[model samples]
Target: MQVNKRPYGYEEQTMFAIMAQILLIGFGLVNTGWTQTDFFPEETQLKTAFTNTPIEVCGRVVDQNGFPIENCIVCLTCGVATSTRADGTFILSNAIRSNQLLTVTALGFYPEIIPVELYLPTNRLAVELPPIILWPSNGNVIRFLFGGDTAFARRMLDPLERAARNEFPIENPDALISVSNPLPGTLRVVSYVKPFFLYVDYPIINFESVVTLDPSTPHWEKDYVYFTLPGSLPAIKTLNIDYVGLGNNHVYDYLESG
Candidate 1:
């Protein structure tokens, strides 16, 4: 066999390539701070897993100072009542058996009672009652709203399947109930894989049925519609418009598909 040795230039080139890859990886890790946390347990036990239950009971609470009270005690049948946080909110759910009386009590404010109905899951109640009128003057009603995961992109929203893309794609819980509460226009969003919470004061809904004449198009079976901007924009001679709010859930989906 003849003795042979590779050129020093090739060896130096290979070493330099390996060092460059190592430096790039280190720079990436340093620039981008990412952490991994366990959201779901590895071993899901039937006892620990929550069986899907329809959320029925809902409500809110307010103090004498007219401030939303959070984490006050909400109870049924002298059972364990959930505490309200500083927002003066609580909920009693139908996960427990029905035909129970919901009682709410706090330190300085008077306690209120709510009767549980047989149709508990879909029913809404008001547990927080206003202080009884000692004098005869009407009061202003405070308004609040709640819901989440609503696709509120101000554009033509396409189907979700057209949204998810591979590589370099941009991407984007508890309660108790009260009866006769003051939550007008409040919406509760059901959580799926991506959980979200929303509380809107004035929800102006402009939802329309998706219109299509063809059956073989990309967005064939999905219901979608377009939203118009409030006012017309004056044309500029040397400017182009960029969809600034496209980072939202719906627009991001459309962009991914496009």
Candidate 2:
């Protein structure tokens, strides 16, 4: 057999070419103003995935007379539960953008449910909700239900688009596509536990994506993976979420503009 040798710089040249091609593609993506809708035609009209940045939720719990309620349990229905400090303040960290419910309860205070809509604010990852007021009450029974993150983007977009087109088996399919109703695909995604949410006094979740309507580019400089959801998605309201946590590292993937 004859011995054969490769070109001295063949591998280096090939690697250089690949890098150049990658740079060109990245340049095009940055300059062409390609949004999530462009790559997925089914999402053109849906306007989903605004930002998948993480954020934090913090707030103070107080009584009607503005007294700090210590040792109060402040928690999202899905997890990240915490007890308020002596100052009646609590911080829930590592929360993502989404709609959720917050359940607050103490020994002598009546439990209260607060709806949270997590979104990316300008240059901020910590969202401080307004002070929650709790009323004094005698012995009372309450119920709560918790769930984890609910995100509809990337791989989930196609199914959502199909559900929007009435391609799924659901009652009142039209409602799934309605802007004012729960998204069909989102409902389908949670159908197994949908009944649980309905029966609970407070249903909460950790929304893992920034919700926005602004058509903006991804934070290519800082993140390899980023996602966002349209603010108009009706599923947020229809799900009857009580709290949403917006604390995460990727919250600024779209810059302050998003």
Candidate 3:
């Protein structure tokens, strides 16, 4: 038999080509299987499982002052709901995964809605949220009445003395003009303006007086004198005064005793 000579290294090259083809075919098969397994039914099932999983969410609701707002209705957009305790804390046991909204509602306060995104395989099933603050609601329009330099001392005492002696006429006096009364002559002095205070949502005053009964002497250094008796507290309450500004120069007229 005659032996035919082939090119140098031709057999080795042929073996390598065949092996490469086999590897390519095996890799294609593996890649196709992996793609289908990862992107099809299995992936869908995993996402569905994650979405259906329940989580616990806890948070607190408070006012602008950081005071707990009890009885606030805390709920998820998916219908899971709970009420805040006296301490303003609430918990949801079955909060669903994925993107969701957490809503907080309370009487006389603006409602708050927060977006939450929960994912799968978390180390902890419970989520603690930051404190939520709710602002007090002012209806369509808020009205405020402000007064200036409200003091019942010095010259103001003249009217009270006159009223006590029946020398000054007061209309619709709420009380007797006597020292024993809570506001004494204050009601008479404020009689004309009292109606305005009652009609507004907030009544504010520049309480230029130091409200105390320590019998402290006035600061003679200042030309103007301003001080009020503690008995005037009832007048403030009666006017529904929401704020009082004591930033004037005369606030320390009676020294620390004031």
Q: Give the candidate number with the greatest lDDT.
A: 3
Comparison by lDDT, 1 against 2, better one: 2
Ranking by TM-score: 2, 3, 1
lDDT of 1 by residue, 1-258 (tens): 997997679889999988887797777843435575656665444323333333334556765456666556777663646776666656555434345565666654445555554333333332333321111112343222222332322222222323422222112101111112212101221111111112112322212221122212234333542222211111110112222222233332222233
Question: What's the C-alpha lDDT at position 249 in model 1?
Answer: 31
**CA lDDT scores, all candidates in order:** 0.37, 0.64, 0.72
In terms of TM-score, how similar is model 2 to the real structure? 0.38
Per-residue alpha-carbon lDDT of candidate 2 for residues 1-258, written as tens digits (9 for 90 to 100): 997987669889999988887898777743545555466666643334335456689999999899999999888756878999999999998675667778888987777778787756525778899999887764354556767655554335432333322122133434323232335666565654555576556777766554544425556565332343462356566667787766666566556765
| Per-residue lDDT of model 3, residues 1-258, tens digit only | 999998659889999988887798787743433333454778888777777778899999999899999999998867899999999999999877756778788998866777766654744598889999987877855767799988776445444334332122233333333334437577777764665676557879998887765534667586665555677667677788899898998788767766
- TM-score to true structure, per model: 0.25, 0.38, 0.38
> Model 2 misses residue 130 by how many Å?
1.8
Candidate topping TM-score: 2
Candidate 1 error regions (>4 Å) = 1-56, 78-80, 118-258
lDDT of 1: 0.37
Global Cα lDDT for candidate 3: 0.72
